[model samples]
Target: MSGVRLVMARHGETAANVQHMLDTRPPGLPLNERGHTQAAALGARLAADPVSAVHASVAVRAQQTAAPVAAAHGLDVRVVDGVHEVFCGELEGRSGRAALERFMAVYEAWWAGDLDARLPGGESARDVRDRFLPALDGILDGASGDIVLVSHGAAIRLAAAALLGDTAETRFLPNTGLVVLRPDGDGWALEHWDGAMPVAGDVTAGGTPA
Candidate 1:
């Protein structure tokens, strides 16, 4: 294929996730038992691809999730700094209705193009793009076959919106959820998201597959 097929997935849940707490700090948390199962399932599902490269965030959760997938391809997971989870800063470890709402508000604004918006003591969406895009582009440019990027939820979501344009169906990728992207000219095309793939000639120019 002339284009790189990028399979970007979110890391499985963590104890923080289970407790609804924001866990984006360094030397990140390990995956819980349920998270491990989810990782295994993710690996099993994506094992069919002839994965040429496997990349993950510096976070432990991401590395853990990428482990099985990397093993399937007999490749070692490469840690990419830029792909780490959004630094929620002040919100770290704070879990509650208000905290969550505030976190989601920033994301909503980000999706709506408010790249400059930032949570207290945290980075902006633009910050994420600056770091994330280069790492992602490096992978796309260097990979010879399909590749998988095990990244955090917010980071991956922002990259998809920035690189592939906004798609309602992919507004959020659940833990271990993935979306497939293919280079389209100078832009990228969203081929699959939220477990749905596009049927050829059945998709609109807007990129929604029937």
Candidate 2:
């Protein structure tokens, strides 16, 4: 516990996410209705915590996702471009299942620990790690208490894998899921991971005050 406590959470579901489409960047599609609900629930859950700073990817979805929690804590959301999603390039708006199947071969290679394998015109795990790890390091360098990071699914997974010394598959996270990490000397310690919102309550939504 010599370093900062990082709470990493993925953005809630988007229209593209619910439709199984790939969304790499912004002006990304907005969160669908279910996504709104998820965001609200997540905000409610995090509202009880003491968050010093809230950072999110510049992507619209992530910014939208970070809104509620940041507002609840009276903290502004800092857009960290370095923490954006893995660039999917050609696969940007393709259907998720199709993208998965189309890139299955390449994905398998990457998942098998290649780390440098990239999908057609897309970023490799190593590419994402390069951009994201430094941003993460910067956060830990400045942090004194809990900090929430809202980012994409793939980037989150890879970072968690790197932090936890786990395989890519073992580190994958679902949309809007929460993953907690505490610093331990040169590395991090996994605290808790709740990838889904709690089943009860009236979760609030949007960047607007509720």
Q: What are the clash counts of all predictions, listed in order?
A: 0, 1
Best by lDDT: 1
Worst 10 residues of 1 by lDDT: 201-210
Clashing pairs in 1: none
Which parts of model 2 are misplaced by more than 4 Å? Answer: 1-3, 166-171, 196-210
In candidate 1, what are the lDDT values of residues 16-110, reduced to their tens digit? 87677778876678999999999999989988987898999888889999999998889999988788888888888787667776777776687
Task: Give all TM-scores, in the order shown.
Answer: 0.88, 0.86
lDDT of each: 0.78, 0.73
Worst 10 residues of 2 by lDDT: 201-210
lDDT per residue (tens digit) for residues 9-120 in model 2: 8888777765566678666877777777888888899898878888998888888889888988998998886888777778777764446455545544656789888867
